[model samples]
Target: MGAKERYILLLIIDSLIVTFSVFIGYYILAPFFLQYTMPVLITTSIILLISHHVFAYVFNLYHRAWEYASVRELMSIAQAVTASIITTYILNILLFQTTFTRLMIITWMMHLILIGGSRLSWRVARHHLIGKQSSDQEKLRTLIVGAGKGGSILIKQMLDTPAMNMLPVVAVDDDSTKQRMELAGGVRVEGKREDIEKLIKKYDIRKVVIAIPSLSKTELNEIYELSNHESVEVMIMPNIDDVMSGKVEVNALKKVEVEDLLGREPVKLDTAGIEEQVRDRTILVTGAGGSIGSEIVRQITKFQPREIVLLGHGENSIYTILEEMTGRNNNIEYIPIIADVQDRQRMFEVFETYKPNIVYHAAAHKHVPLMEYNPKEAVKNNIIGTKNTAEAACEYKTEKFVLISTDKAVNPPNVMGASKRVAEMVVQGLNQNCKETTLVAVRFGNVLGSRGSVIPKFRKQIEAGGPITVTDERMTRYFMTIPEASRLVIQAGAIAEGGEVFVLDMGEPVKIVNLARNMIKLSGYKEDEIGIKFSGVRPGEKLFEELLSEDEIHPNQVYTKIYRGKTVSYPIIEIEKTIKQLENNNNIKELLLDFVNRKEYTKN
Candidate 1:
């Protein structure tokens, strides 16, 4: 039916309900209300029908879609019923000049029940009692991981819309008291979370839905690990607040991504402090199109910077990030500067024009084996690039300058690590000399899912159907999500002091072989189905990586997940001399070692 037809049909139904309710109320109170004549009964019925219809229009009840009815819709029904009854009571007292007060109470209850139920019944008939079919083999048998609010809502939505192609057969929760309780559509809370694998096996489940939005990352990791199976697909609900606010539907659950497995407790940032540091200020992000740099720009945009300068070497990368930011129409000015950080003159020119209040230098040579083979490129990019940016920031009298360093820089094993160490020293040296700018280095570990990261490589191999390569079974490295690392870097800038190397608390080191195995399982393949190969560690690659050197003591934690390490002071002359030697034809590895150690310093 058309909207007008539906509205008129509902109006007619509501009119009948109002009249029948008043007649029933009069019949129930007939003995007590001895003064009830035919005229009085007729007048009360007329009053109820007219008043109810008028109030229904006021509440916009007939205009609403009953198929999507929820709590708000039910509340509107209640308001209309109450208003109509009150209006009828007043009309009866004035028009009929008869006190049917007791009868009015009876009529009110009956009218509310009949009218409200009449409207809500359509929703029930549409969602719960209509078009439901028997469990079919073609439909996916789904398991819900939580038996809480989110889970209940998800089950209801699924049952309401069978076109989603998933049938919720069971639910599990950690709350022992809730065991054996039935959620909507009779999906029982079968057992505790530990019984997931058993439940999946018993039910022949094909899909797992994590419906607890408040679950900690640690708990999520454990659940994902338990649910990893060749036949099962995993999905998760969005944040609980979003679901409750109608910003997201319970049925709109997303597939679990690689970053979710490494998620930790959500970081709580110092928004006020960050705002004070970034708001209304000119910000410069070097390598802004890169993984960490791009995330930094996105987060910084939330603080409403006056202007953002996207500085990178490649034009395509710079153009892509600029378009994304502008397409959002964030209303913040973005200056895209395609300049290589290795060029000192270009860095100076950009800084001179922008005069950025804060500079986040994320440009560096990160891939270890590649940097080891081309040591000169590593030095020129990681080391000299940093020096150029730092010198330019200091020269321009920037308020705060942050260099993105890595865990590899802790105890050097490769040219990449040594170059980062030397870059850290350059920042320290500049902090000593330049009194105006607050120079600091933020050190983190491997960023999960970044370009050229192992996660992507393993995912591709899994998709290709064989031989997922791992450097070694024993090799492990600390991992943090790109957003987590970028946020920490911004936090470090906010809390920076001159000459401090801030280290983020990378929760724990994850073994590469285990990560690979999890990826295989997540891909719905058994280990035998897709073989894992142990390629021996490559050149300059260590069996493990370190976050901080043994001699560097982390005496204070500046923020949650952020620690301040005691600064290591090296002579500026020694650093400059090492750079000079690196410029000429010399043993790149020896010069890098001497630069990092300062023990066997030789003047060029």
Candidate 2:
């Protein structure tokens, strides 16, 4: 309706209500009171009609759309009605020197009901009568998981806005108390989560919307696994806090991705302690362009450091990170240094120039097969580079040095893993000898979306509509997200005293084939649609990755989900001699393999 028409209609309806309420009130009270004669009652009714219309105009009741009325609108209605009757009572006394107190009270009560109910009835009629017709004809039946505040909000939105394309049919919650409870728009918490499949069949549900935003990753995976039994589409709601804060709308739901299933619970850290160490301190991060190193840079920026020195071998990757950090954190200082970790002299030069208070050594040759082919580069980058950085840290009296080690370093089979194992020894040895600098190593498994991780490879293959390659059906690896890994790395530095090798608790080892299958499904394809190829394991690749070797005992929990791996006594001079011998040896690959095998052999 047009604005003029709506205003006119509301004005006329309110006038009739006021007139009727006053007339009925006077009729009932006329027989009891002789002062309230028929003429006097008629005159009083006329005065009330005029006074009510004046108050309603002053309160702007006609300007509002009653169909969308809420508490604020109802309060306005009460105010206008009260003001009209109060004004009538005063005027009747002033003119006739008499008052009909009982008559006015009855009229006031009647005015409230007739006016408030009329406005509320429009919303009720639309939701129950009109909305049900549209929902039944056009909307898809949606089953909502989680019958909490988030689910209630989603149900109201769906009912109020049919253009959202789905109507909530039923809700499921794990809390038994909530069962048999009804939510907004008549959506009921019919049963528990285990009954989801049955409810889907019973209601002929086409879509399932998970409305719990605060669900832990572990619980989310369990719920999704159960919900995926049917061929219906599944969507997940974004964080409720974000929605409430207006960062996103309540209807902003997205398809559950592969990362959601494989991810673990978010790691909580001591931000105050981290800030005390990093704030106002000059920090240097080697390999600042690589996946893990770059994320470390980003995470450290949150600590508000005095300066962040981005030292990397590649100019382009370094430039990319520098640009991103510049745009995101313009208040902090970022110094981009293009230098390789293998250059011992250059490493000392960068350390002396920056004089960084804390150092995060992340540069290393991490590709297993490629490092297996080129063992010399692995030794140069992983072992010697670590030695140079560790020794430089000690010389410059850097407060703490954190080396990023991997799970492959445990019972090492590949040159890359062996190199990292020796690097850990280098850091521990330096920490043992030097009292000024506290050196520690953090060991974790493959990060989910790192530069050369299998996640991106599987995604590419799925996007190309071809066979997705898996090394072996039985091969398994522990996975953590990049942010989680980087946070734990910083946590290690926070918890380190000296010479401690920290191991992160990677929840479970996921089978490689299962990872591939999930990626295919997330990409909107079935197993048969995208063929799975069993590519034989590559050289230096293990059937399963280990977080810690058998001899490395975890004697302490430094923080939750983080443990301290006991440092083995290895002579610093012996480790130095091995590095020198590696440079001169013609059979470098054999020596590297033996170096790692001897460590495991000693463990036995």
> How does model 2 fare in lDDT?
0.87
Model 2: ten consecutive residues of lowest lDDT: 595-604
Candidate 1 residue-wise lDDT, 519-571, digit = tens: 87777778889999999999888888887776676766779999888876667
Candidate 2's TM-score reads: 0.82
Instruction: Tell me the whole-model lDDT of each prediction, alpha carbons only.
Output: 0.87, 0.87
Evaluate residue 120 in candidate 1 and report its C-alpha lDDT on the 0 to 100 scale.
80
Residues forming the 10-long window of minimal summed lDDT in candidate 1: 128-137
Error of 1 at 380 (Å): 2.6
What is the clash count for each candidate, in the order shown?
A: 0, 0
